[model samples]
Target: MMKSILFFLIFSVSAALSAQTLTLTEQQINQHLTTQLGRDFPINLGSWLKAGVRLADIQVALGRQEADKARVSGRAVVILEQGGVRRDWDISGDFSARPRFNSEEGALYLDEFELLGYRLNNQDASGQANFIMPLLLQSLAEYLAQNPVYRLDEQDPLQRQLKESVLGLSISPGQLTLQGLE
Candidate 1:
């Protein structure tokens, strides 16, 4: 009887330890981004810009670079009003991104964007896009670095959720895997 009890305990512990990983699929990730893009975020460009940035289209490629990085292609339009004259600056660009994990907040933010190409009003604005599209995207790498996109808990109104969370991340082309810490 004693031997049987000991074996059962050992088996249960090992199983629990190995089953601590979490994974998110590529489709799931894109769905989340799409939902977010649909929402209009009001941005004040101060003197340089005067309008809202509308994210028209966005596509994310995971595992395109390394296991922990991603590539994104997106399009946005900035309504720039200069001297009471408004112009539609349609921009299309692609960049590489990576996630910054925060254990304290139990969230991950997509950051480190490298602008590969940018076009404004049908003109290539790689060199001048910085000054033109100031309201829309001026170095999104810096902006997203401070924003958290994924949250592991806080689903309910006021509840303390998931005690043990993902400690490490392994991102692949089609999926993101979370590994337990310790």
Candidate 2:
């Protein structure tokens, strides 16, 4: 019985050491975001002064910059109706945000988003974009904050074991690493 107990303790220590860190590639994160966030496309940005906006064609890029942030780029379609005249405009831009993990949910989310840059396809739409971009940014931030970019698979034993023990998340070029305090 003592021999069996010693063997079991050794095995447990080895398993714990092996599971100390979990790493995910950038591609994995991007694919997860695309699959999860795609369903909510063409989100309307309520009308203001007879002008309306919609967001679609969202794309995510992880570890694109040296900073520890994920980059998201997408197109915003703007519609302006004036005196029964309708026009459509396109504004495209990319933004970056720091990633955070929620231990209770076993999920990854974005925080502290910063708009990198934006441009209107039609110069005439500059005024509209100026008025609408802030709203678009806020909407995107709120949506992403609530929705996870990636969720841990509780069915997987290693992931399940690591979920609650994860002490912090780190982003390097092209990769994300989760490590436990121990």
Candidate 3:
């Protein structure tokens, strides 16, 4: 009886220690981003541009690059008002950024964003598109900086424990894994 109890205790402790890592799937991350971004759509471009933009159909790819980075692509509608006339342009763009973990906040954030490419509905407006891209990127960067791409649920006992420790973040083919740092 004594031997059986000792073995059981050891087994339970080992199991708990091994389960310290949290993994997030690509679909899960995309869903979270879409919901969070949806709240702040039709972002204004400030007085200097006389324009605004809205993003939709956001998608994310993890571990797509040679380095530790994430790729995000989405469709944007740029609304420009000139002489009281409103014109809307459709644009699609891809962006890449490094993923970082904020232990204090128990969240994952994307940092150091880079625009991979952008396409405009009218090729003739390529020059104008170049000018508008920076503004759109700025808006996105600001939003991401303030918002987390994924957050650990403190309600779960394991996740709550994870929130208190430093974690090492890694990207696999289609998932983000956070492992507790010793």
Score every model by TM-score.
0.71, 0.71, 0.77
- Once fitted onto the true fold, the runs of candidate 2 whose alpha carbons sit more than 4 angstroms away are 1-19, 36-38, 41-56, 76-89, 122-126
List the global CA lDDT of all models. Answer: 0.65, 0.73, 0.76
Alpha carbon lDDT at 150, candidate 3:
84
- lDDT, candidate 2, equals 0.73
Give Cα distance to truth, residue 109, candidate 2, Å: 0.4
Q: Please list all clashing residue pairs in model 2, or write none if there are none.
A: none
Which is the winner by TM-score between candidate 1 and candidate 3? Answer: 3
Residue 182 shift from truth in candidate 2, angstroms? 8.5
Error of 2 at 86 (Å): 6.6
Number of the top-ranking candidate, with TM-score as the measure = 3
Q: lDDT by residue for model 2 over 14-79, one digit each (tens)?
A: 867765788888678777766653243343554433544565566666676746888877776766
Ranked by lDDT, top first: 3, 2, 1
Question: TM-score of model 1 relative to the true fold?
Answer: 0.71
In candidate 1 the C-alpha lDDT for residue 62 amounts to 79
